[model samples]
Target: MKPSFLASLLLAAVLGAGGSILLTHASPAQAQTSTASTDTVTIFVDATFGFRKKHMATQLTKTHAEYAARGYRYVDMAPYNENGDLVGFFVTYSKQ
Candidate 1:
């Protein structure tokens, strides 16, 4: 192999490894702050195949109440599908 080619490959490998190490050593607090900056409250809910609309409504209400009790302002509700027969929901909130 040519000397210049081998040097370039070694430099690239070193840079990639350094970048990965930096990311891995990042502080958890920094990560949390970054995530919090994107949104205030994050709720994750999952229900089984037989979960009814009413059940979801009730669960959402309760989740809202809990957030309210914690002095969080309600933002939005996002729903998603989990697996094949489970439904997932997210209730966003922000500190008041």
Candidate 2:
């Protein structure tokens, strides 16, 4: 094999490994938090009705405020489903 080709392959391999490591370490805690959020959303959806995206957004905002007042960090609010009469919502938060 040509030297330049070998160097390029080596660089690619190193970059790939570095990227994998960075991605792995960067979000382990976030991933756990995301799992927790999914659980929370499932619970919230199960306990509520008429959860449209717009309504969920407002509700999540209020929930975040309430949680924040109690010392929590809000990560995000995502709409899972939006079919007519069957809506789903997910709220994500991180501990402060």
Candidate 3:
């Protein structure tokens, strides 16, 4: 009803609207990151006898080809170890 009270109410409404807008909108980078995360799949190869370079290389090559044919691209590869022993490998692929 009073002038000061009306001004305060308007300010509060503006601040609330701005906060809601900010919280509801996502940046481009964040949107892309979330999309990329969901579009990626990790392939794990089990090696009971430990990782041999030649065998692992051949297996990875075949895997790359298989995924590539399905419109996927290689993203990353890392060795998986357990108790100080080389166990297998984790290969990550993402949709192109």
Candidate 4:
């Protein structure tokens, strides 16, 4: 092969390798995000009786406060009851 042909081949190989390195280094911003998992869970708070209702209120407040500090938010909620009385609340929390 000619000397010029060899030089061009080497130049192309070098440029390809350099481009690969640059691409690897260029995407660091994407890697900096979200090592923590996005997750979901449902918590059941019972409000069966007068004392239970009070306890459930405090517990729901405390649970929300705890999860909020850890980047969790309410996704959905359902109130469960028998007849006209409150039975429980199912609160869905998500961290995204």
List of clashing residue pairs for candidate 4: none
Q: Candidate 2 — worst ten consecutive residues by lDDT sum?
A: 39-48
Q: What is the C-alpha lDDT of each candidate?
A: 0.62, 0.51, 0.67, 0.68
Estimate the TM-score of every prediction. 0.50, 0.39, 0.53, 0.50
Which 10 consecutive positions of candidate 3 have the poorest summed lDDT? 24-33
Q: Model 4 compared with the native: what TM-score?
A: 0.50
Candidate order, TM-score descending: 3, 4, 1, 2
Candidate 1 lDDT over 1-96, as tens digits, reads 999999999999999989855543343111112254554756565443244545766766877888789887887766755345435566677777
lDDT over C-alpha atoms for residue 47 of model 1: 41
Largest TM-score belongs to which candidate?
3
Alpha carbon lDDT at 61, candidate 2: 64
- Give the lowest summed-lDDT range of ten residues in model 4: 26-35
Residue 47 C-alpha lDDT in model 4: 61
lDDT of 4 by residue, 1-96 (tens): 999999999999999989855543342111112335667767666565343466776877887898799888888878876567776677877885
Candidate 1 lowest-lDDT run of ten:
25-34
Query: Which digits, one per residue and each the tens of the lDDT, describe model 2 over residues 33-80?
Result: 245434322113211333233565565567668767866676665554
Candidate 2 Cα deviation (angstroms), residue 60: 2.0
Model 3 steric clash pairs? none
- Tens-digit lDDT track of model 3 for 1-96: 899999999999999989844533322111123363468777676444232445766777888999899898899988876667655677888888
